[model samples]
Target: MPSIWSPESDTHITAQYSQKTLDQKVRNKSALQKECGWPVEAKRAMVCLPLGMTEALGGQVFRSMLPGLFTQSMELLILGKGSKEYGTLFTELQKEHGHRIAILPASEASVHKILAASDIALFLANVESSPEVRACLSYGVIPVAPECDTLENYDPVQERGTGFLYAPAKNPEQTAWSAFAALARALETFKFPFDWKTIQRQCMESTK
Candidate 1:
């Protein structure tokens, strides 16, 4: 069974996509066009990038990460100055692959809202007992972070078993790739009762 870890401070809640969100996904193409500015040819769906991660963790490694992750047609909505700083690395990366990624700038909460819209929140925080991870899980956003044994807590991605875990120190760029692969594996092979899916579902239900 996969286990998801929560902050010791409070019980985590499990949340479903809000009715307002469902309405938009179902009825508001024009709104999405204006808001997200997706190309008419591109799919409207996009992965969310959270604000805190964008701010705290979107360092040099993050700048180097985009081209690999967004090689496919994809977009981003970064919630801080971090995205702007992300430019230099992006520009360098564009020398190899250009104009295929979109970035929307805003505040952290907006990023959180976008993250909530996502299947999961991909982030890295060396800190253990993270409330951010707990909050995201409650909202149905699985967290993918590099695993650090020195951090002295169970791997959130492994323990909560809702997301992915990588050890960048060990895996380098392969770390992110591993997380994505882990996500695919989870979606395909996820089990319940004896798995993290049940735990995440219960967390969401209890939160309601």
Candidate 2:
């Protein structure tokens, strides 16, 4: 039987997995953004951090990187539930960044919508063979994750691989920095539409 994620499958899937044309992808993204109450605009990269929110899930590390990641050209969407303190932190950050940052409950529907609309899936926690990572790839959302057996580190020179990966660090500060650097690289690549689309396509193809 064909995998459900495969384009050949009978399952109805989002544009991210449907091998859509560029125009179709843009239209779908715009519609999803409007549905999610996000701004529908050109030249803005949508980055999503989904799943549980807690210290163990890298909530603190993500907080530390907010100043650097929340740029004018980027919009962040965070979803999940965990830790009242971390929830407050993200709520405060959302206020500070205005529409550039949004926090949403991690309902299955919301998570699926964000994954379909996002340009990048930001994973700050140390994860190996994570289902979340696979889900992002299936949705054509390029990921920035720690180096792991499950993901292939993107090779810009060769224009290959599924996503970006940084080596995990023992020190918390160093780990944050490494993750930041990897995300920075993804943001830089986002500047070039053709290259970014190539990577997105690669991500989708990987799951098949």
Candidate 3:
């Protein structure tokens, strides 16, 4: 089963976080390095997103804005879970882009590890019910959610300024880029990850 981030369990986590507070998370600067093997001061603009959302988010205005926002070195990790059935479009995305694209088959444990190491989570599926977003928040990770219908009802932040929501959800690529940029900004802004105490509080509040 997909990981469920119900407020029922222990609420210190969700599925995504904002990368705006990168500079402030000095203590965690070590954790990301230690846990996911990312270099300290690793400021590459990257995003880990599900593939279906990418295709769904494909619109003109958003795609045009991405190149300017992300560095050529910045990477985008596309997680399909091998079930997204978005191969044709994704192939084009990689073909059009260069080394900036890294596609992976989704495995819960491995994805969790990647999220632990990643700076931002770009969720396009309108499915942010996973508690891992909260899990990411505890680690100072942030998510950029497309303002799609499914996500409209859920609070990506679960109440604490952990993640961000990109409105209109039109341009998948540009929204992803904007999310990547937002993550960088968020990391620099909220450096401190929420602890279990806070997570539990989130869980309690969200469940209600």
Candidate 4:
């Protein structure tokens, strides 16, 4: 498992996995946008879906939410392959959204870069005890995940919690709504850089 390390901290660990300082994270985000051919000046939130794009993994729910989720200030980068139907769906969405949406095959080569650049890791399905979620936290990527025992819900009053969580619902529509609401809160917080950084720091620290 990947671990988060801060330069300011005296504690040390084995250097088995990659380590990043907050400054490197900022640079990586800009470099990733450039590598993807996205205009850096646009200043949009980079929302990443790194898991496989299958209905079993919330592909259908995400499809239903895409229209409302892809606001003018947000960009979607999907980094995995799955069903042909979803491949077609995302391809069509890319056509409609142009540079705002991108799909790339998930691989070891690209996973870390995507995590480093993304403002949020979006999970539409339950991800309790998921290594990917932990990896995202290690990279200081905020997660929008289902409410589960492994994660903590962000509290605005205390300015605490590592990421955002939404209540899971039996109904697909209700689940989608809950996910959307959680993401909306994240997007709103993104507007305030200081607060967002505080959350990012908390996310990185959680893995320690």
Q: Which model scores highest in lDDT?
A: 4
Ranking according to lDDT, highest score first = 4, 2, 3, 1
- What clash count does candidate 2 reach? 0
On lDDT, the stronger of 3 and 4 is: 4
Model 1, residue 120: C-alpha shift (Å): 2.3
Task: Go through the candidates in order and give each one's C-alpha lDDT.
Answer: 0.43, 0.74, 0.45, 0.75
Q: What is candidate 4's TM-score against the reference?
A: 0.87
Instruction: Score every model by TM-score.
Output: 0.54, 0.86, 0.49, 0.87
Deviating ranges (above 4 Å) for candidate 4: 1-20
Check candidate 1 and list the clashing pairs.
1-194, 3-159, 3-160, 3-161, 4-159, 4-160, 14-203, 14-204, 147-166
Q: Which digits, one per residue and each the tens of the lDDT, describe model 2 over residues 59-105?
A: 76776776677553788788857788888887887777756777766
Residue-by-residue lDDT tens digits, candidate 3, 1-208: 3343321232222323323333333433234344434444445544565433344444233355455535434456666543344555455776776445655556655454455445566554454555555444444345555443322222335534435556534545555565555444543433434431242233224323
Q: How does model 2 fare in lDDT?
A: 0.74
Root-mean-square deviation of Cα positions for candidate 2 versus the true structure, in angstroms? 3.2
Point to the candidate with the largest TM-score: 4
Stretches of model 3 off by over 4 angstroms after superposition:
1-41, 50-73, 82-85, 95-98, 125-132, 146-160, 169-208
Where is the poorest 10-residue window by lDDT in model 4? 9-18
* Candidate 3 C-alpha RMSD relative to the actual structure: 7.8
Better structure of 2 and 3 per TM-score: 2
Model 3 local distance difference test score: 0.45
lDDT of 1: 0.43
Cα lDDT for residue 134, candidate 3: 49
Error (Å) of candidate 1 at residue 203 is 5.8
Steric clash count of candidate 3: 35
